[model samples]
Target: MICDRFYFESIDSLHVKINKLIESVAIIAIKMQNDLRQTSM
Candidate 1:
């Protein structure tokens, strides 16, 4: 039972990390889009 609980905790931590990474990528993408638009103009 302890092992199963630990496994679920680990999975939860991984999910949090993935969410952070995705948010970072999204911010970068938005910045790039803005840069492209400014340059095009």
Candidate 2:
């Protein structure tokens, strides 16, 4: 029982980290797009 709980906790933490990483990547992408538009204009 203890090992199973630990495994789940680790998975939960990993999921949170992945989510944050994706969020940052998305923000960076949006910034890059805006920069491109400004340069073209």
Candidate 3:
């Protein structure tokens, strides 16, 4: 039982980290797109 709980906790933390990474990547993509548009104009 203790092992199962630890396994789930690890998975949860991994999920959180992945979510944060994706969010940062998305923000960077948006910023790059905006910069390109400004330069093209």
Tens-digit lDDT track for model 2 on 1-41?
Answer: 99999999999999999999999999999999999999999
RMSD to truth, every model? 0.3, 0.3, 0.4
Q: On residues 1-41, what C-alpha lDDT tens digit does candidate 1 reach at each position?
A: 99999999999999999999999999999999999999999
Q: Candidate 3 lDDT, tens digit per residue, 1-41?
A: 99999999999999999999999999999999999999999
Can you give the TM-score per candidate against the true fold?
A: 0.97, 0.97, 0.96
Residue 18 of candidate 1: its Cα lDDT? 100
Model 2: lDDT to the true structure: 1.00
Candidate 1 clashing pairs, residues 3+ apart or interchain: none
lDDT of 3 at 36: 100
- Model 3 pairs in collision: none
